[model samples]
Target: MTITSKGRLTLSVAAFATIAAGACAEPSEELIAAARAEGMLTTIALPHSWCGYGEVIQAFKDKYGIEVNELNPNAGSADELEAVKANRGNTGPQAPDVLDVGLSFGPTAKEQGLLQPYKVSTWDSIPADAKDDEGYWYGDYYGVLGFAVNNDIFPDAPQSFAELKDGQFANSVALQGDPRTGNSVMMAVYAAGIAEGGEPGADALNKGIAFFKELKESGNYVPVNGSAQNIAQGTTPIYFDWDYNLLAMRDKLDGNPPVSVVVPTDAVIAGVYVQAISAHAPHPNAAKLWMEYLYSDEGQLGWLKGYCHPIRFNDMAERGVIPQELLDNLPPAENYARAIFPTLPEQSEAKDAVAANWGSEMGVQ
Candidate 1:
């Protein structure tokens, strides 16, 4: 998916409202009352600090007065899928009501009958390619692959992937998580593959795996998982992660190390995470309400605060609802406008390839 700077990024919020009123029941007071009576929402693998979830969760609870039980804050995308399957038929607190998974996992879960179809009110504002036709899941937010440099650790940061493997950053570079299960690492490898002259679609991951092994052999790949805490503690200084995640770290750190993020010009890949309702959600009403709030203008703005590019960002921008101050901090819209995203089919194929080859090819297992 290629998003251009001017024409495509501007979508009117009024269009969302019109679609919401026409298709859905306008999220009536009865829905809210029912959700409040259900009194609980169970979720899996949503870390608070990632992509404004910290604020988003608190806001939902404060508004609805419902209890939210978040399970396994650090679980990977694959773990999320397993939990949904494992807890089926058990309407207990441990059973997840919703899932926010890597884009590829969304379709796979839907195919296995793990997801239920429920379109949010703002669905019309979302790009067609970013959502499933039947609403089993929809893209929520996205970020480009970029380098998050701890400026204090290396004042002259590596601006490109080539520079990262140039022998100056040996034993320093680290990926956010393991590629075998985590989408972030997988995309990082995919982008690196593009830099190394591989093809555009899922089949190009072989080149990415080879590149990582080369980095590993050069003693440059730090095998440990990367995190904001690791960067702050000086355990992992040169971190390769999503632009939003790294930008949030900078705000969280507040100049402790003065992180500088760079979207590599040589190779770029934008990964989007999708939101879905569990097939057997214990609190189905609450789960639906949560989706309503997430896609609302309020929710979209909340994601933008954490530096994530929300699915309806263009629509909000056109309606002039997005804050000017927030827009100021965002990288030029063109930077993301020109980004390339893999189609759902491409993501599915790539994920399969990674599952089969990542461990043996990159020695990451």
Candidate 2:
């Protein structure tokens, strides 16, 4: 991802609407309800590659019978977070109506006084672990963390990190990036811990560090931002990435050669893509409406079509919405239960570790 001096980043237009920026107004039910009645919605968010945003974006318009005017719908999580922070909490013009960010950054944003809360109608469907206790942010579509291997490169794609580092895969491997900046990579670490012990109680962090360190030494480390194209081409034979990207890339390259994606036998870590009303939003009502629809059954089903795992597993199964390909690739619903969100404390701990240990351990700044 590229950043400018203003610190603004461009994501796909859909991502901007998913968790990006739109507008801001004074917080008021009357003001928001009036806007909803007027049939107008302006929003911002992050885009998913599986073409998921369009489904829900259109749904919002149909459900509310509104004219949607979403702006800056092309920015990364950091871009969205900065935009919300820059705009929210102001009287006018400077605030965004809502915010959508990644799970790891949600706590950081909330702790910095960047978000406000509104419990949607379908809140019950969302696991308590996915939403903020104070309602600051809510998890929407989720991705399971795992290793995506180019089977063409590795005749035997290793199922565990130990095998990954010690095998012939050494020179062909790639790690997404830093845990703090990369959601999937962080989940990989957490998943490794879960595989070694269990999350919030396991000692996988140290093991992950050791494994990655050795992975780096093995000359297999592809440290670039995870590129599905690169992975498909075998520059990165063994890579860690989100399930959706892995699945999408595999399908996209299926004709080229066989590509493999798996939920590592040891564990899985569910990373929640989050949504929050920006502290300084131009359309708070629209933001709220968007949140409501996102949690609705119709919207949740849209998630499955886009190849993302909806937060409501039973709902997806009952609707028969989970795809056979994805289902076949999954470990189990119980495996997803291993999902964890980064908290303020976890952020602090990771920061200290990255500062105190990552550079020397992983050879990254």
Candidate 3:
């Protein structure tokens, strides 16, 4: 099924509806009652802006009438795991019932017995490779690395990773978080390595470290964590993050200083973020309900509106459920045609390499 510029799919709506009607069942009434009785779900490391989560969360609340207690919106994947560990015995508001973390963190969390398994109703639609057979965790959405530039600060945005090294961007480029712990930051380094012609595994990671080392040495890399406020304030004029994040930030900024999101032409590295229920959840039923909502068509569309490619995008597209406007608003589909999705082992290896070497090798901590 091809997604043309017109945002139309080749699959007939009648054919898809017949298949989808039987496939997409509503959440069970018993589950809804149980979730409502629980009343709330605690979640960690979910930023309102990332993947259009603000809208998604609100929608879930509106639909289920369950309060969502969000914790540490800016925390990274490692932080999310630590939160679960720190609050294992606590059922208070501080405890996180759900986690949305980097793909590599899923298996690690499960191995550590930090996650509980509960497959959503739409689990079959998820690609087999993107989910664990036991349903401990599943890929939610994906996006490629890109640069979000404050146009007011840098009139001519850098179109590629190579361009970021130029002296013209001195003290301007910044990663969204610390590479030592942040998934997106680590992936940014991987993307850089790929752009520098390094092979995809350890070699690319090492080269990526070298690339950042040079950037820091040349005074082009800003040590501060980048955020939407930082971009508007011109503190981190060129921020490295997922394409969806930058696009969402651009929309939120609304031309104030005018943000420009560029998917680097040199290398396009796609990363998937997964969702899981915590093993020690205070509101297990609510957490399950939240997962059910996220995998639903409405929830998937929310992420798409935020510029993320939902994990079940192909399925929805085939079903002709995705809105044409959402498809039209996305960055050129060609930009993602070359996106490289690293394997689980590759991501784990690269993540470990960054965690161990980022501080010593780049001296950026």
Candidate 4:
């Protein structure tokens, strides 16, 4: 349950290449042929701005010539599970072939018999704690919760959750999504509770609900869900989301309104998202191939480019395959060193608390 950043790891080029070659070996010809014959991969809840998936998806298509049918890009983790259950008998574009959902959702989906097992070639390199031993689901990338601010609206952006409660931030703050279903939003609340001196379990979640209620009472919390366009347009100038998401928004906006991403010193809660193939995937072979690409060195680096710390980050770093420029672009390593990774039980408890009380306690529709 405790996750720590290894900072920067280094190795000589010769040794690095030797290790990287074996770990990132290409998929088998049989798998490729089978996947190509399927011709398409259906994915749900994958937004282009999340985890550098925009370029990652394009790269997959370019490499394998397999068409990717992306379903509702903005659906939440719960929505993804529902999709699998709803499309169990449908062999259409609507049935997701693969899923990338919050870590807590993985076990729930597996328990529901909605996930299939298949480990990637680089499976050995992935941290054991971050993966399912049976290969039903595995961690892809992780990031700490942070704030994304529009500089045009607030020349000096708020740096902490406490700062967000000020009159200056009134009508400016928004969560990435409704905490009732959005994993990121639930974590955002938990992080705020930690900032407010609450512990990591139900206590923190309850405190988080109270914190949001206070913010709402002060007219600082916006009821709208935050997004890239909303942030750029200054409607939701202060958005709470994953650091990678905020950073991606900053890059995509190109400073039209300028944005700042801040990892608050008050509390740093890191969240990991996992990938899995649906049990009744329409394109089974294509789903497996997609998993292969995501866990490969190239796919990992693509996530790094978007500011996510890929689950295999330490493995790749130690192998010296990570480019120096990418390392330099990430937020200071110290920011992550202080991050608190909640256990699965703690996350479930907090999620339940937030889901049950967010609307009633915070009074946000």
Candidate 5:
């Protein structure tokens, strides 16, 4: 039983807990009713612009009539983990019920006992490498690294990592954040390392660090947060970020210089973000419902509209569940299918390696 501002009510935690345990019995109707009774779900670190979450949240509201209170929309993966830990046992709107974070962060959150294990109905459809066996976290979608260039500034944008080092893009290359903290920046380094002939392992990031060091010494490598506005204003003409983000920027900033996204032929690195429920979620049932919806056909297609490749994409395509037009709008499917993906251990090791050497090797704080 729990009491809200509206009134006092009784809830069956056992039944809902069973649903979260991925039991053999179906509890969809019960879960829906309970979530509706709660009438709200709180989430953190979901930027409306990233991966079509703006439309996804709206669609969830329209279907369930459950209000979603999104907190710290721009928070990063670390921030999301801290929010859950700090707000544990507090039943309030600020206590996040769900979390979406970098793949490596999922295991960290679980290790810290901040996540709840809950498998959606479509669990079997998700790839084994992308999910936890106990279901504490699962990959929602993935994106490959790319260069988003402002064509107005450089008519011939740097098409490869080799080109970026030729002094042509001096003082123009912008990374989103410190590789020590930002997953995107870290993966940018990973991709660069692979391009520099480093092996596909965590230790190989040293080569990427060396490449960036050379780039910085050559008067390139601007240490500024890259944004669509920054690109439009020519502050950072060459931005390294995810293909989905760069592609979305092209659509978002439609006419101002026009954004062009390119996947460098030398190296392709892919990263995934996973979804999990907070261990102390104030709205557990709603969180479960949200996961269920995300893995559903409608939710997966919603992410596709935002240029993200859903985890179940191939399965849906094989079954012909995805619309033809949506399929047509995506970038070359081979680009994503053929890219290299690091294992969880490798990702964790790489993140730690960058955190240890980013400042000393890259000369950026």
Candidate 6:
């Protein structure tokens, strides 16, 4: 979280460019001073184990003296929104300071008036689609939708979505649980649609549904969470895992043979996660300040360590945070050149579509 002096963060769109030039050289002294004056922060993560977040939060606390209280470690996007609605206009002792959520949800949340806007100075560098037009939320780390192949399981691994749909891999592939249940998985549907001609501004996800239908006919998918453990133990052959999970798994295996991550030759879905501040944030100033830091060069670099593609902020890539090895693991910067980020308006429609038609359209609850 950060300090919001008169509802403004330390960094500004005009200053983001200069600040990126020398953030670590001399941290934002002005920003930190503002945070000190504000005094506290609260953060919310839609609860995974927060393996990377653990280190990030510790540093935030140590540097700012703000308690980064992360509530609802296991909640989903829906849960967070409900909290926002329940606590509408109440940035009290129990309200949230910050929120961690999917890219699609950022627009949905902002459109619903559930969020507050803070355009980090790096705002100019960020792609227009990845963040809200009004700065309702800013995407941090994001990944492309891809199929994770286990070299051990398929003698001749599939190379494309079409191959995954081929009958040869019957009962071998795993669905990313239900789109109804997993936000990351849900975005994949939108991404897969891009492969099927669902261009920008298309309201229909029928292409996505068709692809899944073919997979179903192939009997290639098993209902399960993104449990890479299944692959490690040979319980499942392949699943739709992220680049980081596959890379981290390879690192642990001591060799790359057991797993491989791929970016489909067809269009890649732009699945992203974003950060937002509460409209009723008690530490509104602190929350805003935290956003400034989070979007700063120093902050964006933190995700490079987590194996995520940092949102483009003030040409952040020029910095030395990403070494050669990590860059190799990433699907070449060029692959991201064509990636599709969600808009708030598009996301609102998609979320509603998923909720209203997922069961009948995709056999998902």
TM-score of 6: 0.78
**TM-score of every prediction relative to native:** 0.92, 0.74, 0.94, 0.94, 0.90, 0.78
Q: What is the lDDT of residue 115 in candidate 2?
A: 76
lDDT of 1 by residue, 237-353 (tens): 887888888888788889987888888877878899999999999999999999998888777777887888888877666555655566667776666866888777777767777
Collision pairs in model 6: 2-285, 2-286, 2-287, 2-289, 2-290, 3-285, 3-286, 4-285, 47-73
Q: Per-residue CA lDDT of candidate 3, range 142-183, in tens?
A: 999999999998888889989998999999998888877888
Error of 3 at 119 (Å): 1.0
Off by over 4 Å in 4: 1-23
Query: How big is the positional error of residue 335 in model 6, measured in Å on the Cα after superposition?
Result: 2.4
Q: How would you encode candidate 2's per-residue C-alpha lDDT over 148-257 as one tens digit per residue? A: 77767676777765566565665677766666555556567656655666444224455566666766777666676556777766777777877776776677676466
Global CA lDDT computed for model 4 = 0.88
TM-score of structure candidate 3: 0.94
Q: lDDT, candidate 3, residue 82?
A: 94
Which residue pairs does candidate 3 place in steric collision?
A: none
Judged by whole-model lDDT over C-alpha atoms, candidate 1 comes out at 0.82
Worst 10 residues of 6 by lDDT: 1-10
Better of 2 and 6 by lDDT: 6
Backbone collision tally, model 1: 2
Ten contiguous residues minimizing lDDT sum, candidate 2: 1-10
